[model samples]
Target chain A: MGITGLFLISFLMVHCFLNSLIFINDGGETFNLGAEFMAKNWVIRAMEIVLFGGLLWHIIQAAVLTRENKKARPVAYAASNPSANSKWYSRSMGLLGTILLIFLIIHLRHFWVVSRFTDEITSGKETLFNEMKEVFSQLWVVILYCLAMVSLGYHLLHGFKSAFQTLGWNHVKYNSMIEKIGVIISIVLPVLFAAMPIAIYMGLIK
Target chain B: MSGNMNLTLKVWRQKNKNAEGKLVNYQVKDISPDMSFLEMIDVLNEQLIVKGDEPIAFDHDCREGICGMCSLYINGRPHGPKDRITTCQLHMRSFEDGQTITIEPWRAASFPIVKDLVVDRSAFDRIIASGGYVSVNTGNAQDANSLPIGKEDADLSFAAAACIGCGACVAACKNASAMLFVSAKVSQLALLPQGQPERYLRVHNMVAKMDEEGFGNCTNTGACEAECPKGISLSNIARLNRDFFVAGIASDN
Candidate 1:
């Protein structure tokens, strides 16, 4: 879970950075160039396979772990005050991961399918940036993206530090540093991803 | 400092390990505010015994709280609402006069209920048997100054040693994980020079035993530390993880 989680986290960094190119405000020229490179580059295409593998593994591990954990206590507590001890998000990783999985399906359908399978971009009929603008044009799509980003933010907040601990990288001397880095990644990455759709919808990024 | 008052009690009653458990309500009158939580239960038990009723079966020993024998989940919190104390250490004063207090046994697949409020925590004993020990020779007592151990390591080991093998960490955990208990044992021994000869073997065998015992994995939720009666720190868990990983890679066996 930790290995795959950190793998996906790194993927998010690259994805967020590439998508943020739209803020160049050059009528999508820069963003489209980057998107075209990502789609056509053989190395990127190969890494995409590994990326999907990591994602699938992370999801499957989560499902298996959740099931095993549930089985560890067949009898539920009649009344448990879990919040008194731990953070809400720390205990809700499975729920947050499920939400992110649902969002991933929607997101892949919105952009990835069109870019990979369809000839719209390849035939010069449409560009990836124009697709983004068209997609964000709908208020509901924009709202869903924002909500998904919120879920992503909370998920990463716990996941980043948790992965370190699971891998035995945690120690008293460097724990604060690791946690600070986790906090930064959790906040910055999701905010950037969310900002893209909102920027397009509000005409801040044309 | 108030006078004794009446209170309602909802205690879990299970005839045996195979029998179904339920919360049976009973009213206790004029319970002293100064009494310990277990003492309150003793009052109810006396009432039940006098009336020809089966008394609640619970675990208790060394009421001053050193013994990990007492296990009770009171009012949704393990060891009651107070922090860093066993159920035996919780006084009636922490609760209200007319409150409805709920009592329960530790619930976990690894720690099955033997009766009403007594669970079979022998799983912990097995885990300890697997690796929680040193294989040093026991001759005449070695000089304490021979080791020349650092104070920080000694303090850390002492803190980890404070774990009483009580399953409160498991009861409070959402996953019913024994990581805190296992980690405490690992940390206590791994920090000492006498524990070095079998360090890798200890962590390796202990973790394997823990997994085999059907305890859940630790997700680092921090519940175990928060509810631990001895105030065991989460750093012990980190140490366990570190030693476990290094053992995986470094151990010849």
Candidate 2:
């Protein structure tokens, strides 16, 4: 889970970067070029497979852990004050992950499945970008994308440091620095991913 | 005011391991503010005994907070509503004159009930047994300063060694992960040369045992450090993780 989580973190960075190209706003020329390279490259095609497998494994790992945790305490505490102990998101990983899971399904259906399963999203140089513009034009899709990115941000906030901790990559001095970096990455990465839909929907990059 | 108060207590009561438990309310009138939390409970137990009812059962040994046997979730905080102090260290004066103090056992999937307010924490024992020790020593061999340990290492080891095997970390956790407690033990031994022989294997065995015991994975909530009466640091957990990671690759025979 730790390895795969870190893998996903890198995947998100690459993904957000590709999506950010849409900001170039040259009628999707640059974004389409990058998207075409990703689609055509054999190395990336193989990695895409590994990425999905890793994601599945990650989700399953969380579910199993959650189940064991829930089972460990057969009976609930009479009264709980979880908020006092940790942040609400720290306690709500399953919720945040579930939200991201929903967003992933919608996200893939809009682009990935369309790109691969049909030429609908890849029939031209600007097909994928056109799809993004079409998708984000809907206020509800834009809202859902923003909400999902927020969830992703919160998930990574705990998960980034947690992955390193799980892998045992820590030093007394370095761990604090790593955690500080983790916080910035968690916040910045999601905000960057979220900006794509919001930017397009607001016509900032038309 | 004479620093005395009358308060109602809602204490958790369970008949046995399999039976259902609930909060039983009791009135302890005119309680002195000077009494320790356990002393206050002792007074209530005395009343219950005199009234010919089964007295409330709780775990306690050294009432000075070193034993770590006193486990209570008072008013939703582990070891009561105080910072860095065990329930044994908490006093009645911390509460208001007419306040209602709700007390419950440390509930977790890992620990189960022996009776009311006394869960069997032998799971912790099993984890320690799996590997919280160095196998190299039962006899005296080395001189006191022969090893030339660093001051920082000694202090860090002592800090980790301070954990009292209390399940408060588990109780306070949202996932009931024992990473903090496990890390404390793993860190203490791993810091020393005597512990070097089994360093990798020790962390590997302890962590595997922790998982096998049905404890949840850590989400790094930092609750364990917050509720630890000994003020156990969370950094030990990271060290444990580091060792565990190393062990996975390096411990191969």
Estimate TM-scores for all models: 0.97, 0.95
lDDT of 1 by residue, A20-94 (tens): 999899999998889989988999999999999999999889888888899999998787788888999999999
What are the per-candidate TM-scores when only chain A is compared?
0.98, 0.96
lDDT of 1 by residue, B1-253 (tens): 3488789999999999999899999999888888998999999999999999999999999999999999988888899999999988998889887899888888899999999999999999999999999878734547656768899999999999999998999999999999999999999989988888899999999999998999998988889999999999988887888898899898886
Q: Write the per-residue lDDT of candidate 2 for residues A1-206, one digit (tens) a residue.
A: 67988999999889888888887889888988998899999999999999999999999998988888787777777777777767888778899999999999999998888889986756664488888888889999999998998999999998888787777787777887988988999889988888888888989887
Q: Which residue runs does candidate 2 get wrong by more than 4 Å?
A: B138-142
* Cα-based lDDT at residue B37, candidate 2: 94
DockQ-based CAPRI category assigned to the predicted complex of candidate 2:
medium
Q: Give the clashing pairs for model 2.
A: A72-B109, A73-B108, A73-B109, A168-B241, A168-B242
Q: Which ten residues in a row have the lowest lDDT in candidate 2 chain B?
A: B137-146
How is the predicted docking of candidate 1 categorized under the CAPRI scheme?
medium
What lDDT score is found at residue A88 in candidate 2? 87
Q: What tens-digit string does per-residue lDDT give for candidate 2 at B24-123?
A: 9999988999899999999999999999999999999999989889999998889988888889999998999989999999988788889999988999
| Deviation from native of the Cα of residue B233 in model 2, angstroms | 2.1
